[model samples]
Target: MQEQSDNKQPLFYEIIGPAVLKERIPLYEVIGTLREYMNIIDRSYLTLTGKDRLSKKEREKYKIIAYEFNPGSLHIDLAIELYEIVQLVFPFMMPAGATGLWDLTKSSYNFVKTVAKLRAGGEDPVIQEDNSIQSYIIGDNNKIMVNPSISINSDKIEESVQKIGSFISPGAVEQVALKDMEEDGISITEEEKRLFNPETTISEDTETIVVKIYRLDIESKKGKLYILEGMEPKDIPFQIIGDQAIGPYIDALKADQLKVNILREMAASLTGKPYLKRVLLVGFPGIKPNQGKLF
Candidate 1:
């Protein structure tokens, strides 16, 4: 690892296989894998900091810089330095001194270790009182605790890991290892790639609910909905399942407060919590039959 001017140590991600024997790597593969790696870090940071989104200043302070590339199977060195302001702005309540910069570093390291465990097809994660996760490392079985919100977005992390795995090839790129400066980390082999697939069971049961559409992408058939009935409202990401026309969703967006009955499809996790996945529009309330049929 290269010497860092700051107190923070540089992290390394090495792509191992015959492809890197020439001390060179493909542009697309490296770039794509790096992007997913960054996403994992960003998601972990958001969960640890308990913030919905990072501000412009916070983004600058928590930014990761890829400074040096080392020989021997293509290693990328990355570094991140957190400021005191970033720690002080924790919106959710955390234990005193838990929001320190070193605490953030430890959290980040634990996040990667947790991902590694999931990739290796470990047991179901232990859900904390705050709905966070507790994961154990593979070899040493070290416990890592993560304090996250109800909307932790574990699906995103799964998606990112799958994306990174997609770049792996049998003879060319066999394994990718994410390690610290001391060379302690997890290695993801090609055969273990399938472990990152999301374990979700589609429910046979369906429910009709009213939700306010916040964002919609007609081409992608995906949108975000805000459920209004609960004591603590939640914004859920959903995909249009069937060949449903986009007209009704567009109308709902324009109407803003229109109540609509949607057949919601949910995915149940190992924790037995049902999460919204897809929706099919069934009926529109307070609208004339002819008007509704027009959509």
Candidate 2:
């Protein structure tokens, strides 16, 4: 498990300003509009070192959105999460056309790569290297993209929502409270520390929210298999078409039209409101439904 030392805070920029159009737009058109107004979300963190030795070794990034609104200040928890919600919709609205649609529902890697390049003196590693890892990132391969993330802090849930409504749609969103903290020991590097801090208003910037996007291709308990590679177990029971494999998990893919609409409505609301600063949407693995025996 090698660790990635080059992690940095993700940036979400808006290509389109907050303005809703009366006409209904196609998915591609939405993506194109978002490209014009790009929004950056999510920050990077250390995973493991790629030494192939130690107890753990693999350089990767972890997703953790941290926002600091006066660490010791009094505020509503939901307001902060709402603030996070505002962060989520902002990015989705901008990258509505090609970039957004292409990377749509896939993952936030492309969005993260774009930030890395912007922070790296505008020198895209992918542009210099033919096999740059960033090439796999959805939007980076061709153009700018948007990725979104969602999370509600339990203790700060109330505050997050209220404050966030000021930025996003002023509606009541369902907030589910969890009993325990889902702690995953994701690592972070010096560079990532600098990047993550400002985006969440934790250490540096106070006006930005960070997000990460991921691919929702498989079930939570099921490991992913590249069907085209013919490496899956014969009992797995699946079919491969082009680069994607149609397996039990494939059924979960949300309809493109539906996804677009959901995003569009979100965009319209956030854009319509002028009280928000920016929304950071992070992409990641989609939640898989349980296929066990029904009760």
Candidate 3:
């Protein structure tokens, strides 16, 4: 929806979740409570015309709303961004639907391909680029909503993380046979191809390797979340807000466990712990996680 010059007041942009049984675990709700404290930010004001002219003093009061780790909250990100354009970033909605920020990384349109959105139920509608910021809900008069459930299909994000890791340390690590890794939307990096060739010097001893990344969304040019060994273990619930959220959480949990163990061995090498058995300092290069002398 494009921003329109109209005679209307700003409304809370509402987001709806999928129609699933068992309340579907509101990503914003946990064991039995809603995390409302982090959900609401202080109010900020902007209009369709004045979006680009926010003074430093005004932006200082911009409210940042944080939702639980829910994929249904995809609209929240846009809501926050759109808030900069219009005074209100959210919209009103009927009860009984899911709301909050959800991950859009695995959504069908996010397959690194040009995706078009068509009319769900209408006589005839012009196809719109699904991921276009031009269609953003800011200043639109019509109802706007997105299904985080819709974006949960693809597994490309996990593969990209794995591939990036592989690029950094080729055959030095093991891989899980994740579904749809070879699918059309997903890509195989050059490092992945080299892994298939036995003669390739995929592994080489190096002094250091980068741990995590600071990646940006290509289209939006927006900063996104980064998963590294250190953070995932401590953030199982929050990590649920990503590509294939549940599955990736489990995978990352496993990885973080190995990271913890490796860090343990490393800790021991520095100075032996009192009760724990000492890890013999073996000057091994290219030691992969779960496959080194820590065992």
Candidate 4:
């Protein structure tokens, strides 16, 4: 439970299957993996301090490290962010053990709120207030994660897609697909025109509607594996190092389905208990794996 900070390092974990009987998925193994990833990052990024006014080699190293860790590795500062993202994706993945998942989510959510509050008055807000307005509509973190999973269904997915009809702007021809809609001067379907035509004059009597999002945490060995629609998905593993290893270790535990099963098998092997069970995907979102869809 070491605190994550900019000056320190962080770690992430994944569990594939049953929670109980896990070990080859041990804490230290994850910590070791993280250490390797971080030491290299640190060796390059550490400050030039006191006498050392910064060396050319050090600066070059820092650039290389930054490039490697940029969007993939969960660095110290981003540990909490990643945790919040995980919670947003799966609200109840962790158990109500000594330290409850809800409480953890609340803590993380509050931390973001506090930062938002501080940022609101600053010269520049690091994160746009409206960027996460969905969090406000959903209230707490757990609600944000759960509501969307249940609300999104196969039937509704198509319905909503059809109803929304591409989030286009005024005077735009409705395109056949979302991508086509983005292009200029594309023709739209009648249904799409009616739903999204900004030019259509509406009477003041029109009523507002609230669209609810369904919570989903699609679980499977390939659950984490997703296609980013037109783009490619990056396979970035969590790297944990130093005192902040726990977070990444936990993340790694949550990532792989087979890892969880291995942990359970190991636990059973050691304890010989017939009922040492642990729930997997405690709050998994049931988004069907539509390989073509954007996660």
Among these predictions, the greatest TM-score belongs to 1
Instruction: Give per-model TM-scores.
Output: 0.54, 0.18, 0.17, 0.15
The candidates, ranked best first by TM-score, are 1, 2, 3, 4
lDDT of each: 0.55, 0.22, 0.24, 0.24
lDDT of 4 by residue, 121-164 (tens): 23111221222232223333322222222212111122222233
Q: Which regions of candidate 1 fall more than 4 Å away from where they truly are?
A: 2-7, 88-146, 149-156, 198-295
lDDT, residue 13, candidate 3? 24
Q: What is the TM-score of candidate 3?
A: 0.17
Candidate 2 vs candidate 4: which has greater TM-score?
A: 2
Supply the global lDDT for candidate 3: 0.24
Pitting candidate 2 against candidate 3, the one with the higher TM-score is 2
lDDT of 2 by residue, 5-90 (tens): 22222222111222322242223423432222121111111001111111221111223222321211111111001111111221
lDDT of 4 at 146: 26
Best by lDDT: 1
Q: Per model, state how many residue pairs clash.
A: 0, 82, 11, 42
Model 1 over residues 1-295: C-alpha lDDT tens digits? 6554443546778888888765477767778887877776665566566565667866866766677787778888876555444454332443223223323434444454365444244333332323333322233343334444312434334456678888888888888866665665445676446444334455443344657886665645566676675313555556655545678778888655656555555444334455444465545555323323322
Least accurate 10 contiguous residues by lDDT in model 4: 260-269
lDDT of 4 at 79: 25
lDDT of 1 at 257: 61
lDDT score for residue 59 of model 3: 53
Better of 1 and 3 by lDDT: 1
